[model samples]
Target chain A: MSSFEFTFWTIVGCGLVTWLSRIISFILLKKFRLPTSVIEFLSFVPIVIMSALWFESLFHQNLGHLPQVDVGNMLASLPAILTAILTKNLLWIVIIGILSLALIRLVI
Target chain B: MDDVLDARTGLKDTLPTVFGYIGIGLAFGIVGKASGLSPLLVALMSAITYGGSAQFVMVSMLVSHSTLLSIILAVFLVNARMILMSMTVAPYFRQERTWHVVLIGSLLTDETFALSMNKLNRTQNTLSFPWFNTANLTAYFTWIIASLIGALLGNFITDPKRFGLDFALVAMFIGLLYLQIIADQSMKKALQLTVVLVTCILMYIGLIFIPSNFLVLVVTLLSCGLGMVIKHVLF
Candidate 1:
């Protein structure tokens, strides 16, 4: 297929997958009243998921054993994590994280 | 009071998102353009795709002339978190049309998702479009504007490692996770332990197939689901 075909299908397929993942839960949830305990815990689900995701990227690696710790990793990750924690703002969080990583790499 | 927030409020919330997206998008644009996309086209893609990591992948793939299926698979994997995110926010949008929900889901990103989930958790009332759309629009605009700027003034970013900017995203995510736990201590402890344990186990397993971008998300999600079931049975 042509590049255009690929891009088009990519968009269409992704939109479908994304929509299905998102919309399915809503449809399913409508049929049953989830237990209150489940609901409460579910609320925290994102917190768990997001943290795991960010942690992996910050500390882990693409080509190695159990996330070998590098100085750059810590320097890039620590300050960014701190900024996100302290301010609770996305803009600042991203900026600070990127900045911190960049600075450490630049300086040391 | 029941139907209080609307476009105006949405517009207000959206402005910050737009600004944030624009600033960050500029960086992406520079990177993307240098990698290949014409600056203008990169800006266009930023507006259309309206996602951070996905756009990053798309530009790389497009530059390498990757197959359509390959690009889709890569993006699909990277954005799998959106599935969980969409599921989280789905309950709040039953009143809207289905197409609207799908389109909105396409617009979903880490920042907006974080904001929307918090808003929903705080209020038990039915959802509305204004605030939701407003917040999304803000982030979307920000990405477009930022990409435009970055593309226009492309430059090889100097050693970013020195400023420790690379750590910001991890830090931001950590901060967000910590805040969530603050609302309920048990969940907090459970999440913390789950993150640590899961990371240790995954690292021990040495699975490099999955992208690092997805680690915390996948493990934390699986563990949280397990934790929820355990909590359900115990109490």
Candidate 2:
């Protein structure tokens, strides 16, 4: 009755939505053997949208005040970014990023 | 992978990425563990949801005392990217049996996206769907093992304030962005600018005011419409 109920029932709702998204493909591909060109175009959908989401999450914070930049957040993140680029390794990124933050007190 | 690659290409194509997955997956697992949830729960969510950002969002929401509505809003918005991913694959999948698509879709995660995108870009003919399973299995195993380790030792590990762990996620994204931008210039510009603009809007405007999930909805609908318009007008 009340909206405040902490029911995990929401999982059922989300699962239903997720299921329907892929259901059509299963139906069509099995029965009709859908065309190849259609599949090729549809394949781009994930990467393009992911690129969008990635952009939104990463640059959204830094965009408005760019050029002059706020020293506070940028300083904390720079080490992790630099290490990841240089080493191309995850352990290095985590370590370098955390150490850079510990030393962040010295910067600001 | 065996027949597809020669002996020489083995060192170059597969090893580095697989090694990196071990570490990245671990970072993700431990982060989930540190969120105070059980590792079993984390594994289940990671396996079923198959979404990296949503996993992080769920953990962060748990930490920040977020309302269930807010958590759903954020995740729903975050998972909106999947719509674009699905739509792109939808038309072609019409032939595959339903359970097959469902089996693979449920395991679709970031690594799966990367592997599949690269494979599709290269191949010219009908793809064996098992490649999707290979990619998903690799990512799933890594996330599961790493998270269990992270969960058990989660309390003991030393680090910055919770703020630092938060920074770790941001830094990881930045590094990934830099690599991506280098590979494709126009895409990089679009993505980097998108990242900056969205972050600024969400941080300042706060997701509560505007339906932040609307960003995904708006962009996807616009892109789909543009595709339709181009098909009608240009072709």
Candidate 3:
């Protein structure tokens, strides 16, 4: 198939499945009740997922190299972490983080 | 007053994601164009699939000349975590109409899910649909616009990382995790710290063996299961 044809079909299939993945669990759970324990467990999902994502981002891995802490992200996190503690505000944390990293990049 | 607050909160909460999306979305567009996709098609892909990593994977696969079937399958695997995420948030939409539930599900993505989950917990399991829809729409449009601009500016623009735009999402995740931990009073502080610490170590180890496409989903499941067991034993 041509490149355009290939890209088109791939996108169509992907979009369908992507939408399905997001909606399937909701559809299934609506017909059946989730156990109380499962609901309780779900409460922990946000923190676990966030921590995993953060770690994946903050640590860098390359072919044949052991994962190493990202110095830039680590340094940037200082001010962002302080902001989170000080105000617990999302926007402030993000702003401080981006600006911190930008300045760090500028300096180094 | 309450409705206005809800809408304002949604926009406020989405700010970080909007920043992150612009960087990543522009990067994705440039990559797509480099892979020989038309600018229009690149934006359409963002509008359609709307999965950031999946789209990137797709373009890379295109460059490598992977079959259409494999590309679709890879996209599914990369995005499979959304199933677990969707289930976790499903209970919130139980009272809404079916159509609304479907809308909520499709709009769900990693960043938005994390943001909405925290907001839901803070508000005692109540999140206004309009609030979430607002967040989703903001992210969605920002992505489309960014991608289009990147594609149009294709060769002229260099790397997105020079300005440290890539770190925006990482910082946002850090902030969100901190908030989630502080907002939850049920678990002991020590246990919460343990969960975060262990998950990080396990994920680092997992990355050594598992493909990143599946690593996040696996680590999240294993870590959350451990957390539940610990919480069950204590308090």
Candidate 4:
């Protein structure tokens, strides 16, 4: 296939995959009752998923590489993590994280 | 009064998330443009795919000229967590129509799921679909508009990292995760959190051998499965 064809198909494929994942559970649960254990299992999904996202963003160099600790990201995360633990406010944590990173960038 | 209050509260509660979305969305736009995607295509991806991390992965893959199958598989695996998220929130929408449920499901994201679940757990009020929709729509529009703005300004703002904006998504995730932990507030829950975190870190380190895309889905399943097993065995 041509490059343009490949790009078009790739985006279409991605859009389909993403939409299917989002709506699959909704479709399935409509017909079948989720086992209580499965529901209980699913409850922990957010925490686990979010943690993976956090770690990948903080440590990973590229998409699927070994996570080397970046000094800037690590330093910024300290304040962000602390703010998260203390305030439990999403906005404050983001603000502190950005400001901390900016400062670190300036310093080094 | 209650409806207005709920709507207002929903909008108010989502402001932080909206802020985070704009920041990340703009970053995605810049990265997308830098990766050779047109501004229109970046906005289109933001609108259609609407998965932040997956879109980032897509852009990077595009830049590298990765195959279509690999790109699709990667995006699918990265977003596979949405199935669990959709199911978890399904119980709350049991009373709504199928169309409404589907609509809500389509709009589900990490931020929306966190906010909606938090509200459901705390309130005695029935799950207000409209209130949830308000949060979803606000974040949705913010993402699209910010992407367009970023694409338009992509030429001017060459280096987004200089301002440290790349860390916005990570900070938001950390904040949301902390909130989830605090809301649970039990020794057992804390242990469960620890189990999940440990599992994710181990799997992340294991990425040296495993393909990154596959590891994410595997880690999510294994970690959440571990949490379930622990809850059953211990509690």
Candidate with best lDDT: 3
The 10-residue segment of model 1 chain B with minimum total lDDT is: B158-167
lDDT of 3 at A27: 83
Please tell me how candidate 1 rates in CAPRI terms.
Answer: acceptable
lDDT per residue for candidate 2 within B32-121, as digits (tens), equals: 666666666666555555455666766676667677677666666667655555554544445666676766666555444544444443
- Candidate order by lDDT, highest to lowest? 3, 4, 1, 2
Cα deviation in Å at residue B124, candidate 2?
0.8
Share of native interface contacts present in candidate 3: 0.67
Native-contact recovery for every candidate? 0.46, 0.18, 0.67, 0.65
In angstroms, how far off is B186's CA in candidate 4? 7.4
For model 3, the superposed segments whose C-alpha errors exceed 4 Å read: A63-65, B1-5
RMSD to true structure for each model, in Å: 4.6, 7.2, 2.2, 3.0
Q: What DockQ results do all the predictions give, each relative to the true complex?
A: 0.40, 0.22, 0.66, 0.58
User: Of the true contacts between chains A and B, what fraction does model 4 have?
Assistant: 0.65
TM-score of each: 0.74, 0.58, 0.93, 0.89
What overall lDDT goes with each candidate model? 0.60, 0.50, 0.82, 0.78
Looking at model 1, residue B78 earns an lDDT score of: 72
Best DockQ goes to which candidate?
3
Error of 3 at B129 (Å): 1.4
For the second chain of model 4, what is the TM-score against the true structure's chain B? 0.87
Model 4 residue runs over 4 Å out of place are: A1-6, A61-66, B1-5, B124-126, B185-187
